[model samples]
Target: MVTIQLITVKVTAEPSDAVTEGDTVTLTCSVSDVTESMRLVWINSDGKTVVEKTLKEEKQEQGLLQLIIQNADRDRRNWTCVLFHQNIPKVLIPYYLKINMRARILPDIWIITVSSYLFVKLGFAVGLICCLKRMDRISNNRNPPKATGNKETVQLQTLNSDADLRSSNK
Candidate 1:
């Protein structure tokens, strides 16, 4: 006498965590208990069958199924795998396909902030230099240096001594 145990088929998707937007995602469905006859099916969060366009391609191998999602976008919905036994499709495991949006310019938020700060600092420095130069030019233009006549002249230093130091007495 022998007893039979049934109901032990579970399916799981690859990258069982998350996916990034604009990146290709591969959801490979593999069954725990391999059986003689089993079929794989993919369904969306709305329980509707997924279209072929959404799934670029599919591969089947040794009780395993593969699904390719191309151009991953925010519009993508969560998906789950189903296995069919005796032509009756049953629920397997549910996978949450999270399309993570990366930062547009930089991956880290701090890098962008630091770069912005540097650019603003540089701009302020340039503005200050230009302002100072313009002010100096205006001041110089307002005040002109005094000029003497065209005749050549000599500057003589006056002495406080009572005696004259000149060689010829006048």
Candidate 2:
């Protein structure tokens, strides 16, 4: 005679809703009647399977899985945990894990951008003022002032060397 037993396992996860960026979500799988053959696993929505090393085994019946995301800039996918029964593989437990990003940083970004632009504009204005000042000095130095039309002349008396010599001999 062949006999079949059906059993359902329960799976639980933390933060039923979405989570923030750079955070970790924990998933727990439990079986009512734990057997040595019970297998618990966590799978991502992307169809990639989690490694055994990352999963922490709480006990024979319950298994704890932690999923840490790199970042949550946008809406993220879901992760589910499935359990394999010892007698039959029909019974399953699933937990959905959703991660959410925080509020948008558009305001901060806008402020920074506007401040930078204003700083650049102020720097250019100062630079133009300095350049104009330098140009004015250069032009003034390049041109020399002209003399007036009216001029003054002076005369000086000269002495003959021969007369001076004769006077000295006398």
Candidate 3:
């Protein structure tokens, strides 16, 4: 009877941030449940082998996968991290790396759309408040003055007689 154990490998990137042009990114390939030593094979998108390292006589217990990308080689590409046992096929996990130069800008149409929506909502609220205040003032009218029927005419006659007496004395 033959017993073959399959090892699981996971790929993880440091910082886990969005990469732009002229930037460097490092990816680590880790293997789990290792009874014996293993090997790592890294391949780029152009079907080219980038790295191959053996951890049989290394001082570190865990395998170290180090990738150094220069400033000019930070463009859009795909990278694959593979772990292979001695006699079995390798297990592969692929990652797509994208690099862009410019940040996505908000469209002018979207800004106009949001601004118009806010204006309509705020205008309606202010108009409703003003109308309610005016209605409240009219409803609370309490002081009603009497109408001027003949009081003005009597006051004017008294004023004329006083003026004539003053002129005669002078």
For 1-170, candidate 3 gives per-residue lDDT tens digits of 99976656788765466667667777777775556667777788886779877767344356767665655244435888877778454688897666656443567678888999999999999999999999888877864554567888777666677978667668
Give the clashing residue pairs of candidate 2, or none: 19-100
Q: How would you encode candidate 2's per-residue C-alpha lDDT over 1-170 as one tens digit per residue? A: 98764444566556556677656555655455343455566666675666322222344344444555455434445656665444344444455556555667899899999999999999999999999999999998998665455343111122234577557767
Ranking by lDDT: 3, 1, 2
Deviation from native of the Cα of residue 156 in model 1, angstroms: 77
Top model number, TM-score: 3
**Deviation of model 3 at 99, angstroms:** 1.8
By lDDT, the best candidate is: 3
- Compared with the true structure, model 3 gives a TM-score of 0.49
Q: Write the per-residue lDDT of candidate 1 for residues 4-97, one digit (tens) a residue.
A: 6354535444456676777787776655444355667777778876732111123323455677788777766477778776667665678777
Tell me which of candidates 2 and 3 scores higher on lDDT: 3
The local distance difference test score of model 2 is 0.57
Kindly provide the TM-score of model 2 when superposed on the true structure, using C-alpha atoms.
0.45
lDDT value, candidate 1, whole model: 0.65
Each candidate's lDDT (Cα)?
0.65, 0.57, 0.71
Model 1 clash number: 0
